[model samples]
Target: MSDEARVVRIVPNGPVMVQGPVRIEMPDGTVVESDRFMCAICTCRRSKIYPLCDTSHRRRQRAKDDESSTTVTVQAPAEA
Candidate 1:
């Protein structure tokens, strides 16, 4: 493999897979580095650890439904 080459793969409704070691520059000029061979960058913003994927992109389950409806359902779009 070339020294300058890295592979980035995008998962279906998930994070962007990036080959590391990667240095991420935050908006405030903070630098975050990862020495792992591969890293997952979060796209969903729900992660407590921002800029890193913690599998927070998955769909949420509603805890309760209205009294009028006994069953509640959710439909997510198919991956493109």
Candidate 2:
């Protein structure tokens, strides 16, 4: 558990991917394991992984698509 190393990278349209040894401290004073051999941090904030990314964004994206089906009502601009 020594050899502590941290890797932080930003993934497009997704969460960050962290590699190497990492320690994530929760507000509850609980330190979660951020390295599952490698960690994929959620940037979309929609990851079911909680503190990691399990590719759950796919489902989130699908839900987003479904939401897009609803038409957005825009009010006309007031006459200047």
Error of 1 at 75 (Å): 41
Task: Pull out the clashing pairs in model 1.
Answer: none
Give per-residue CA lDDT, model 2, range 3-40, as digits (tens). 86566788777778777345665565555554355567
In candidate 1, which residue ranges exceed 4 Å CA deviation? 1-4, 60-80
Strongest candidate by lDDT:
1
Model 1 residue 28 CA deviation in Å: 1.4
Output the worst ten-in-a-row residue range by lDDT, candidate 2.
67-76
In model 2, which regions exceed 4 Å deviation?
1-6, 59-80
Q: List the residue pairs that clash in candidate 2.
A: 15-43
By how many angstroms RMSD does model 1 differ from the true structure?
Answer: 15.7
| Span of 10 residues, lowest total lDDT, candidate 1 | 66-75
TM-score of 2: 0.54
What TM-score, computed on C-alpha atoms, does each candidate reach? 0.65, 0.54
Q: Tell me the lDDT of model 1 at 4.
A: 82
